[model samples]
Target: MNPRRTTRSSSTAKAPHRHPRHPHNPAGRGTGRLLAAVVAATACLGVYAVPAHAAPAATGTEPVVSRGVTIPAFYNPPARLPAADGALVRTEPLTLGLRLPGLDGRPIPGTATRLMYKSTDAGGLPVAVTGAYVEPSAAWKGGGPRPLVALASGTMGQGDQCAPSLALEHPLTIGNKTLSVGYDNLAVYRFLAAGAAVVVTDYAGLGSTDRLHTYVNRVDEGHALLDAARAAHRVAGASITEGSRVGLYGYSQGGGASAAAAELQPSYAPDVNLAGTYAGAPPADLTEVMKGIDGSALAGALGWSINGFAQTDPSLRAVVDAHINATGKAALADTSTMCVGDAILGYGFTNSKKWTADGKPIADIIAAEPKLQAVLAAQRIGRLKPAAPVRLATGIQDDIVGHKQARQLAVDWCRKGADVTYKAVILPNLGDKLLTNHLAPLLTDQGSAVSWLTDRLSGKPVTSNCWTMPVQP
Candidate 1:
């Protein structure tokens, strides 16, 4: 099966220079010196500083930017994965003085104030993966191992930008404030408030020295979620000695990752006690979703699919390389750092127009390609039974990812004897609203899912009271 449908854009080419979004001094005289003084002051105050000469690093190596910071490289593993058992493992408290290499393998200044965490894959080797940790506030007063919530974020494309700490610490600076939206952590916060430990994985390539995030790669996503738990245990200190109850939460691209993690966890990380999983508006059927959104306003999503899948399928890569032109290629590479507006600018207007120039729609081009179709078809979810309880939610009005797909997923899971708590809600007062179209379902589902997860973490028995009538097509 083709698995390259979610490959990330390569970071080798120099990103075209663009002016900084923030204002710069026009005097230009002591700008460099003034910047240096500000960096020093910020350093004293424990704030992160952008390296003066910082540029996106090349593939496979970390780029050193300043005194203690580096941009990390993406992880590109050989075809064969190391055996999972007997891997070297260690745990340590996340302290302010601690630092780990960024995605480019460069030393990134980390803060203990925020509770950073780290874990290594075992094989009797130094584990390289690292992640951020946030503990539940005192309001959560459980005595035993707190419930654990692991967040698998949706597509941020750029490895450097996907770091959760960066998202949490510098939300306004990031292109898509959505990653910084704290929806992932909102679930985490609720769970934590109910006495749960929350761990958010940076995914493989996003935070570690991996070259490209596997996007929705089932095996990789599962591994990252499991590993993040181990890291959280290390950072939160031994008081969380008992293994905590585990739950997964994700949305959109993250939904796909969380679903895959749930399916893979029983065998992948059997020791971790996975209690339940909540996935909202997941693209259970990638091929269908791609067809549904091609050349639409959400067409930018196609770039993520093409890049992600190409990593595993050479034929898919060749097709994309062959079909897209120079500008299209550049635009795809730029997509990782872009927000919705940038997406509209980069793909919606330019790339979409170029691909459809021959009076053929972009979707028609994608459909005409056999390898691309196979790659996407292989990415569908709902083919496996989760070891733990599962909750699925989707909006009745979702236009980007059709609501029909979410319903089908729940039906498929139930038919497979999986305990599925599914909900399809009609978003009121959003008459034909595009913004509400895709998100209303997700937001409604997210609210319910958070409440459900909190109940589970609090040791309440699982129930299906959340389910509603099957949405009419």
Candidate 2:
């Protein structure tokens, strides 16, 4: 989801300046200090209403990533977690603002919880993952136990401060964009309005403090999403049980997670009775997406992906070092410390040739290497059949994650004998306009996608349209 820059004066102190993404609004730099004193005075006057769920009093020990920074104690997982995957580690009550970024000004009436749960990493090592659970204030009018949707957020940058949990607490502004006012929060509000309990995964490393987020790593993302559903059921005050009907929803980065979880559910979490999934604008082929973003507004995303690959895969690291030029090395280093806003500002519409000794995109370098190709192939979706029906939506002229590869996903799954509904959004005007093609459908098609998943969760019969669709090239 593309964040619309915020219009508010910098009355708020930006989260810390450890990252280059935190550009100080000089006009509002010290206002937060004044506001803090006002809050203290107000507390002394005893005029403030208490939050529904009081945060725990104990503070968590900071991790190496933010050694000198202060983080709330709720993010800390227990020192020891059960060896089993999908085990609930610990939970605490959380309260989000009534008004969030994309809610169209409609208040979100609900009880929220922050959950830390056990899940496997890409290599099957047990690790802790954090997520938020919301039991809607809206009543369930559908039927049976209120359904649960594991809502995964799209690219929120790799910064810990950009984590959705923190954004839900106090919106972080990237440039002028406040994260709490974006499409991800809007989607959560919609789910709650439909009377579904929602659990949003911060993904493996994004909120872990010590870990460098893995970005597009499929295994880690899928594991985190499925395990989030497991943790949601165990959350205190949540009446959801193992038998509760489950669905997955996400777009962009989130689309990748939902798609991967649907495929992994058969083996990784066979106990979860998944109803359906709606994946919008999923980067089905990371290699293709990497090439597509090389010189675009999101070119920094390519750097982010490369940085993540180097962190997790040793072979890829060696290859990157072997061919990367000095300029490329510095840019990559700089990208590591910045969030999406700074990345876009620094690297947008820039050529990848400047980064390579051979003057070619990194994708070309990886394509030439069999080992690197294998690494990317492992991250691709459609290798396994989804256990449940899937609804996939992509704009025909999407420039970032091209429609061709996204359409190919439907083809691959259909051949694998899975039921898939492929909807190709036709927006020639938006497509001709450049990047808006990819983002427009996120708003337009979301309601339909939600309605489709809601139908499945309500136990309606699914009619597969795979055979009638044209074969993707």
Candidate 3:
């Protein structure tokens, strides 16, 4: 559906789309204190918020509303697809929704360019991807040109309104009516404040008005991220150049996207040279990750993945449609229009067994269908060695994303002779399947993540820790 609106006057924005490598605050003590403060502040903001009004529609277009938030016109894609990947389809100024006072009186994080770019999906068909590109005002003192950090956001949800570009405008509008927290702002601003340019991808079909978001589909996510880099050069005022160094950053679902982009960079976008990568809590093995999320607080994510898989693969769709009950179908349709916050509010702690026609988990359903298994197997990351040093982190207590599968990504990469540094966040169980265990480490490791990546972007080199890592079984 197309959202019709006269362009609203733009506001200053520091894009909400960057990520870093470590959480140990290896950057400095001041940064560590700031990290804690940002977390606490966002934690407070990440709550049920009062509703806000969407700008009036200018012309006639099917306005897609997710949990009461209207998708903006900038997100609407043109009918024709560009033949070239990373082609700029459209661009506009974006205003971020950060109002933190006393942080040096900075009004916004950076200059945000709301952008729609061309990208190839897993099916090899050209598709439009929406995202934001921000040029930080700080000067680059890293002994080289300003670097570009293409950030893949952790699971925002399957909804168009959940797009990171939109979240930049409504980072904490979550409530009974709607919700989204650009929790990534900490990392995005961190890098921007340090004089790095940042680009955040909305992934294929997530923000664009063409199709449903292909959640965590490796090829789609990877291509969208890499293509964002190419598109950044197309955006006006973007300082990133063809020869600029690039780094990949993400956690959770974003972790999977960054990891996939690192591996695919060699074959898909060889011109985009990589510096380093930090993949935190990447769901490398969909099978294990799926089993873990089945009955968790974010169980609705299971529906999102299934919905995306079905939309991407018709063969898998036929098999999935056969097994899904009416309730399952309804749930998938509902989640297709919801952000992570909406999903949690609506379907927390739900079980997949209830969605299936039979009294078995969807994993069992997949086991019975070879087509489904093959498609899922093809989604696995770590099959290819990444071309840069990678810092892979996972929470030992995280049952939702599964620490083992995430660690296994490092294991496989290490075996492939990739420069891999694995950090297992050893936190006490903060209640299984409650997301606390899954997300606690994100903050704990974010400082180190950013520091590690910053070092790479600054021409710093890292020795591989693969010698201490074990190969996957």
Which of the numbered candidates is closest to the native, going by highest lDDT?
3
Score every model by TM-score: 0.72, 0.83, 0.88
**In order, how many clashes per candidate?**
32, 5, 18
* Candidate 1 vs candidate 3, lDDT winner: 3
lDDT of each: 0.54, 0.72, 0.79
Report the C-alpha lDDT of model 3 over 28-104, residue by residue, as the tens digit.
34323433443456764343354465444437654555555667766767778788899999888887665343355
Q: What is the C-alpha lDDT profile of model 2 across 1-473, one tens digit per residue?
A: 11111111122211222233423333232333332332343232212122333233353333222211223556555668788777777777776744444354433557788878889989767778888899777766676678999988887776554566655554333222211122377788888998888999988867654456788898988999999998888887786767778999999989999999999999999988899999999998998988777876667677668777777775577788888887787767556544554455556566688889899878789889898888888899999999899999998888887888888888899999899988988776553313467777888899999999988888887977898677532
For TM-score, the strongest prediction is 3
Q: Which ten-residue region of model 3 has the weakest summed lDDT?
A: 12-21
Query: Which residue ranges in model 3 land beyond 4 Å of their true spot?
Result: 1-55, 99-108, 471-473
Question: Considering summed lDDT, which 10 consecutive residues are worst modelled in model 1?
Answer: 172-181
Order of quality (lDDT): 3, 2, 1
